[model samples]
Target: MSKVFDFSGVDDFCSGGFMHTNPKDSNLFFPLGRHVDVYFPRKRSHVSAPFVFSGEVKPQPSIEVLPDECLFEVFRRLSGGQERSVCASVSKRWLMLLSSIHRDEIFPAKGNLDPEEHDNTSISVKEDEAFKPKEKVEFVDSERVKSVNEEFEGIDSDGFLSRCLEGKKATDVRLASIAVGTGSRGGLGKLSIRGSSSTRGLTNLGLRAIGRGCPSLRYLSLWNLSSIGDEGLLEIASGARLLEKLDLCHCPAITDIGLIAMAMNCPNLMSVTIESCTNIGNESLKALGRYCPNLKCITVKNCALIGDQGIVSLFSSAGHVLSKAKFQALDISDVSLAVIGHYGSAMTDLELLDLQNVNDRGFWVMGKGQGLQKLKVLSITACGGVSDSGLEALGGGCPNLKLFGLRKNLLVSDTGIVKLARAAVSLESLQLEECHRITQCGVFHILANCGGKFKALALANCLGIRDINFLFPLTSICHSIRSLIIHNCPGFGDVGLAVLGRMCPKLTQVELSGLQGITDTGLLPLIRSLEAGLNKLNLSGSVNLTDNSVVAITKMHGETLELMNLDGCKYLTDITLSEIAQNCSVLTELDVSKCGITDSGIATLSGAEQLNLQIFSLAGCSFVSDMSLPYLGVLGKTLVGLNIRHCNGISSSSIDLLLEQLWRCDVLY
Candidate 1:
């Protein structure tokens, strides 16, 4: 023994877990067993712990004399950044050795560093995957998870697999695995992280590895991730220079620093969606405006710090190139709207929702700004400022506008509707919902003034609309209309339906759900008036309707009918199902939930000659029993989905039997 070097107790140095050394254990110092302090950066705040090396050492030896393998283990044992930094600064060789140690070996990943072990679809989030941390999970997409490896030579553009990690799967080990495994392939292109564990999951370490390895990443989405902050995003901005689209939601830890850096670094960025990010404000938006000239789509919602300054700066620089923009629940007032209207020459779609600060004057100014020449679709909801004058001005401002939708705006009435309709010559469709002031006259004016080009109309929850204004009958009243949806209109009765049936003869796709005012008297005439059979029909929650309406619709539109929903029509019986089975041969979907249909109705439809139905739902049909199981099983050849959820009469054994019979069907019992 030349220097009495004791390397036998080397494993004791790894007392601390994967990402951090045990602050209370002094074994990390190894031969130099002296009391020390350690810090964990992932905690966000500076958190330190004192290590008490109370035990006496058998033989004290210099750490500089340790072998390469011993040094490798020691370096690998140190989890957090501070410890690694402290070690690396000691010498150049230590720094190189520390850099050489891979994250997967240190963190102990679930997947091995090989092609077979890597799950191209997903990755883990915890440091010690073997430790098995509990995490709350959101939807994990398994789309194209099974790789179809059409191998060519070295790294094709589509060679690397797009990964989606959520819950426990979003671990640093998995990120390390993806970094190491997919780098040889074309590198990770797209990644999504949705919802993490109750405790913190992903940190800067994972993103750092991703930065070094998957530099070619293009699209990224992060949702409900509280642990990730500026450092993690900074790493992404530094490496993924070619990134085009980024969507961040409910990530409170990420502030303007991260967003500004990303905007500055990735000049080719095209689309960005920022929702409920409290820390993000004008600085980040200003950076995007100054740096990202190629920005096309921008949606900023529920960010308290964002104001008119941010919106003005963004639209002033990049609005001409933008195709779509949505601003919701922001602090911005009329100034932002005016700036957007002034610069959004190329924008085709725009939405303004829940904006409390902007008033009627602001809306008027935006309309008269005369810059949104190419705007096609516009939706305004829950805004205080959208009045009749503003609507009138907007009609003249956006001449090319094809579709206009208004929701929860109480100030708009018949005057605004008629004025907008007359001025907006290119308008083809109009949708109004929860707009209490919109009377029948407003709807009538839209149809009359839209110059017979109006093809679609949807009216829902408008208590004031006592049907259309038949008193002032215009010649061109929805003559070209094909799709119509009127629901929850308490004032609408048979007279209204009769009027619509006569006016809109070309109606094909119709949904009149939640309308207790109308029965077969109004509906049957509409079916008879159609030039061609209806393709889709939904009469859900129309409890007043019976077999009369169902039988008439099935017989009239039998050939063209593809989908039907008669849910909550408790009066419907086996007769309705018999008509659907016998008449609607090409029907692909049918829902009769909460109906009075018994097993006989289901049995009759199950044995149809060419029912050809793919999706069938009998949920809440208490009359349906186990007797319909075998008959439903016969539909396995063509049926892809079956729902018998609330049928208390059917036993679990019968459901199991039906499951055994139907191999391809997705049965929900």
Candidate 2:
């Protein structure tokens, strides 16, 4: 009975003999104690089997009091993710016990589902499903995830790697457990502590433990950890010699001294991100350029101390191999731009934002220089320095530029677009936003000259494109335009939309979000004109949109559509949902948020045999209540993400009931 006692309110769990479980925290740990060969029930039946007393005070057996062999049996029998979650929620003791169980200890549910479905397979699977599952794709693999052999390729085979602590769970005790546990397990490959926590719970003591134990660590990310300082970082620099990637954000305690130490020690670094760390300056970046030659990607944002001297020095040595770079809110001038243009021979993608001191001459020098011929992508945002002449210079410099994006630039006019199109013959796609000075003449120039290779165009809040037909003739038809996006352009009425229908006939994906002026009359023609058939269509925030446009779209192009969003289309009802369910055969994602959808609408769609959605959103659908929950359960097998936010009519108990029923889906209520 003592073993089965409640392990609650025991604040100093390390000194006392109980687990102080934080219900809200994701990361869990156990205090140092003697081994008792922990175990659990083997079967769900054993867990639920109530004592049937024979009218006597016979002691009942508890899981906590069971033998070690019996405990391991129950843990083994708990195969599915749903069952494991239920077990963890039973009490704090189970959580701490489960923390020590390694990947090899738990066996997968062999006859049945994937890794996600098999709960007892690995701590990797458990952590993935339980903590930050949304960061993963819709049951798809992330490109960042490396194979087992590649993850631990050069390192020794004596470290148990990979631990992530976020929100309230990032603590010193958990860090200590990770540091000590790696000795018995394998080597540490990756570790990350993110977001705000309980009074900056992790400090130098915990980080020092990790540095001493984890020498094979390859990747590390620390964000918003104000308590951890240069001492802890120096320890990591001296101990973790195989570190490859480092990401630091909003970490006020870290400075150039700490980062320089890492750069000098870890020569194998391939990628680095530094954001909002005011204390870090050019010295740290210089160390990276001088020591880390294998680096490929560099991102620096909101670091005011990084001026032209720092950028020039960093790129001078690292520019030969660097391929991707992004700089935002930096105090750099034309000197940095000129230096980058001179040495950036291998650069492919570059983004520049909020460089207040840079002017048109800097861009002109970048284009007029001898480098940047291999550049494929360039995005500039909120830069007053990028004027018409500056764009002309850039277009002339980068001949192979495939994609260009500009946002919130007040200096770009119609002449710049024409000149840029004239100079850059290989231009493929262009995205423009908040350029009020660029009128229909800019669109005319692009379509006229770059029509052969121009395939995609996205315009947002650009006042210059109101009347496309009035500016010029319709002879410049772009047959290759596969994607077109026009968002929040209320001035673009039916006339402009109809003109677009004839101008772009091969569009495969299109978005007309927040275009309140366009109605069924304007949308029906565009839907009918597409020759390649639509793959994705988003008409969200179209308040005037009704069932007429939706029904027609489904009847024509629903068979090939993979994703559709009609969020905030308040006029839509059950009829539209029924039409979609009956026609969209291969549709995998659907969003009708903020619509007038009711319980009957959900039932009609959920009951339909043709529906097979993996992601569904019903946010702000006030008409929906608890009655729609059962109907939604029909898609439990296919759905991985379900959003029920702002649904006022649904009760909390009902939400809990729905979560239990749809154990596989991530319900965001």
Candidate 3:
């Protein structure tokens, strides 16, 4: 018989040992210093300590953990990168739990589903299903997706629309009714139907279904829907009362009646984007002013029918509610410009694109208006009529303007640019593209005025940027310029670039494409000086560059280089690739298309074990073949896109294997 000893004291209890009365048996827990354990009567044996951690037998709570589903709900909220890098590294149990989660669960498959099932797949219909309209075309809305179906090619709008509008003329009406009947139970708030080869034009009937099904819809984006006329838009207005934001892009069928319908039905509509609708006129603007009392933002682009009168009507009616407006590719003249200046007083953001007629007089009128004071972002692109007088007016009128874009405006000269520069000294970003008339004098004036605060400056296709002296003042102006794009500027060579190299030590992106005069003499110093800060470098079409330039780049900017484009650099050889492989480890995108690199060069780079290279382009390399495929397969896990176009040496079978191995990668043949 086993002896039973009963004792209770503070010393025994506090000394990592205790005694408990077991209901099944009179088991006792004793601290023997070395092998403390509980005695079980049924088994007639001693049980080990409940918890043995780090050589200490500590009393532990039972492993009655929460459910896996409960834990998953907490961990799934992490961002994609966080879930993969941080959460998965904790333990095998955690790794398994995360791995068990279906990718579709993490990032739901969006877009229109196929008629056969409700599963989230990009493939909606087979070849036979393209002709059937009686079958319902299922559209499901998901949260922000990273990408859409690119393989849905070869399917045009005619075939897709045939399926959508098939079987019956009243199908759209039925779908709308169904949507409306579902109400808030469907939890539909945002719907984005972007263009796809298989996706057809959506008319009023389709919209009816959306309105009926998604009655609580707050945002709707119908892109490239050419069949959508005012009749369809009216259906949306009537059914979707809660709609606050609507984006109708490239929908030519919509007219002024549709805008009026929206104004009357959606009183809460705060933002509307109507692009490429040539039929919209002043009546729609007047209706919006009268009906949409709370309207705050509007973007009207490529609408030739709506001119100054339509804008005037809109401002006259909804001036108090207006804050942001963009007018692009319009048929507006000086008359419209004056009207905008007079009534657009409440606007904070304004963009004028491709305006053919409005000149300095319009700007002068705006200078005297109330809107100029509140304007913060003013983008004028391809406005040929606006010259020195207009720029001068803007300088004096818009005091708080932080962003100024003057692109494709040949009329803007040195005097105008200087005048504009002096006026907006607080400018943060100045983008001057294809402004051929602006010279070194204008550049100096800009640097002297706004250089202190300027963070981004792009000079593209500017024929007058030849003087090397223009580059000297950049360092004194601001030591840090985040982004600088200099393309098609034939005048500035090695001497000018040396000045830029010293001044732009903080350049993150530098595009020196099409600089015909630049050679190793100019590029090497600049690359070496800005090595640490440069993340993106574009030397495409710089034919004069040799292999030594690549060596300079790898030596200085290996760690920081994420995107490197050496397209059309005929002199770069296998030696360049060898050097890059040995030094650079984090290159995400490397474009060596049309370069004279062969299999030897590519094999070395792909063989590197540390590379996380995602995008690789060897489009015009004729020698790349099956031998290079194995090496590229090393980066299969990280690669997202691979362009092997015109690589005649590669067999179709090898390409198929690559596609199979790298299933997620977008391979271009």
Candidate 4:
């Protein structure tokens, strides 16, 4: 009775499968008859018909999750260097999936793979399976992604192992790693490192890592590295055999030993930029010339140790292969110039700045040489002794020159410019700044001959140019001038600007700052002529710009104008801001400092939902206050730098609130 096993208590005794139910008990048991004739159940039983074999029953369809391969395919789309590292640490599955991805697909062979390539998975498989175990990846605390000098205590114990494992997540770590990984996977075609100098010296350990990581690195740039020495350079040279370009900037620790070793080891090096390295001299140049046969570009700047001997060695060794040479602040004389002229047959671009010892004789040597025939760009600055005759010689020698820049050459006059214009007829850019002796007649002659081909012409602080009537012929002579800068030219007035505005419709940049004589009359016509073509307009200190001028410019060039400087124009008010807010939706930089704009104007500009303003300077605008501060909070997302200095009406509390909201913007009070 307690067990309730009797057939009398069975509800379905006649059926093949019977359910037992005790009258005293609430529970009921059913016998599900099958292969072995065994059955059991409880409570409410729904036993029906004669039981057949219970072993074979169709299962109901159930929901299935995505497979690992499909999940990995989803993750493949997120595989960037930093993205992959961050995702790999999410789980073991993601780590395996990222590791399985082909190295070539991740790093790429040519240029970086397009973002869209990560989405597709049907790429051709590799011919051979030579798999190497992927290095274990860990998430770099984005907060800890700073210089090694910044209290990263345990990083050095592993001897740059953590840095290599962290990969590109840590910027300072990767800066040291760039030397290692550049050519490691196959060939890192380009490597650039601009050091902060705060990290402890990237010692031999880091250097060895670089050598092992980047074997095929073609281009290497190390800047402001305070501690890297000869050993580091040797390691780089040993690993990056195909290095074609090397830029060493402010690396005072590097000496002739390092430079020579690099030149000797990296045979493919074609370009060398060494700046502010005091220890590298003539011997380094000789090594480079003797070892690097393919040398094409040599830029030696702020290097006081390089003398005439070094110049001669560099020219004698690599001059045949050299196509571009830039020497700045060096003490080489006419002898060095002669050496360059004699040996640099393939030279196309030459820049010499502050060459105190170079004079007309040096230019004469270059003018007479057949080696400079292919020279296209010639820039010389502060070479006081170079005169008209030297310029004439230069003009005649390098007839293929397309761009010429001469600045602060006290001896240069109208004669030199006229001679240069006649010889370099294909010149596109002519920059003659602070050349006081260049008269209107000289400019006229230069423009008459080369104006048609001129793409850019800058003449700033030229006191002798009183009349620009010569510009009247610009419509017929030059229609291609894209950049015209005549800043601080007291004689250049409305008439000059009017002529230029009518002639150059494609002007992308027009800097007429400090031309106080220019009023709305000169400004309106120029902005109207340019329409939407102008990208930068500098009318600061013009003092004559008003709401009318702002309205006209914004209406015509709202879409294209990215930078507008109305600083020192005290007459501007809320109307200017309103017009700009309504029309110039894409304006990124607006400098209305020292203007008469008030709180309402600032509010209007900051509230313009469409304006993507990044830099807003309201310096000396006394009327901007707390009322305007709220509108700036709305711009907090896009703003990068804001100057609220001299805005006496704004309260400190409001400024603090604004600062808290715009935490990213550099707020200057």
Candidate of highest lDDT: 1
Comparing 1 and 4 by TM-score, which wins? Answer: 1
Give the TM-score (vs. native) of candidate 1: 0.77
Question: Please, what is the whole-model Cα lDDT of each candidate in the order they appear?
Answer: 0.78, 0.77, 0.68, 0.71
Candidate 2 whole-model C-alpha lDDT, 0 to 1: 0.77
Candidate 1: residue 322 Cα off by (Å): 1.1
Worst 10 residues of 2 by lDDT: 145-154
TM-score of 4: 0.65
Clashes of each: 7, 10, 10, 10
Candidate 4 regions exceeding 4 Å error are: 1-240, 249-257, 440-445, 461-477, 498-508, 521-533, 551-560, 582-588, 603-615, 633-646, 659-669
Q: Point out the higher-scoring one by lDDT: 1 or 4.
A: 1
Tens-digit lDDT string for candidate 4 (1-669): 212233332454332333324332212222222323233444444555444443444454422145767755665565334354444444444444544443333444246754423432222124011121233333423333222121111212212212222222324344432432222222345555566466463444455445544555666777776767888788777766778889988888889998998998888888999999877888898899899989989999988888899889988877878999999998889998888878887899999898998889988887877678788999988888789988888888886888999988778999888888777767788898888888766765665566457788888888776656654454444566777777777776776666666667778887888877888887788888873367888888888777888888888888788999999898899999999899897789999998999888877877787899899898989878788877878776898999999888888998888888999999999
The deviation in Å at residue 89 for candidate 2 is 25
- Measured against the true structure, the TM-scores of the candidates, in listed sequence, are 0.77, 0.71, 0.68, 0.65
lDDT of 2 by residue, 241-351 (tens): 789999999888899989999999999999999999989999988999999989888999999888888899888999998889999999999999998888898899999
Model 3: per-residue Cα lDDT over 84-124, one tens digit each: 32333343344334434432344432464323233212334
Screening candidate 1 with a backbone cut-off below 3 angstroms (N, C-alpha, C), the clashing residue pairs are: 16-22, 124-169, 124-170, 124-171, 125-170, 125-171, 126-171
Candidate 1 error regions (>4 Å): 1-159, 196-198, 467-469, 472-474
lDDT of 2 at 75: 60
When 2 and 3 are scored with lDDT, the better candidate is 2
The full ranking of all candidates by lDDT, starting with the best, is 1, 2, 4, 3
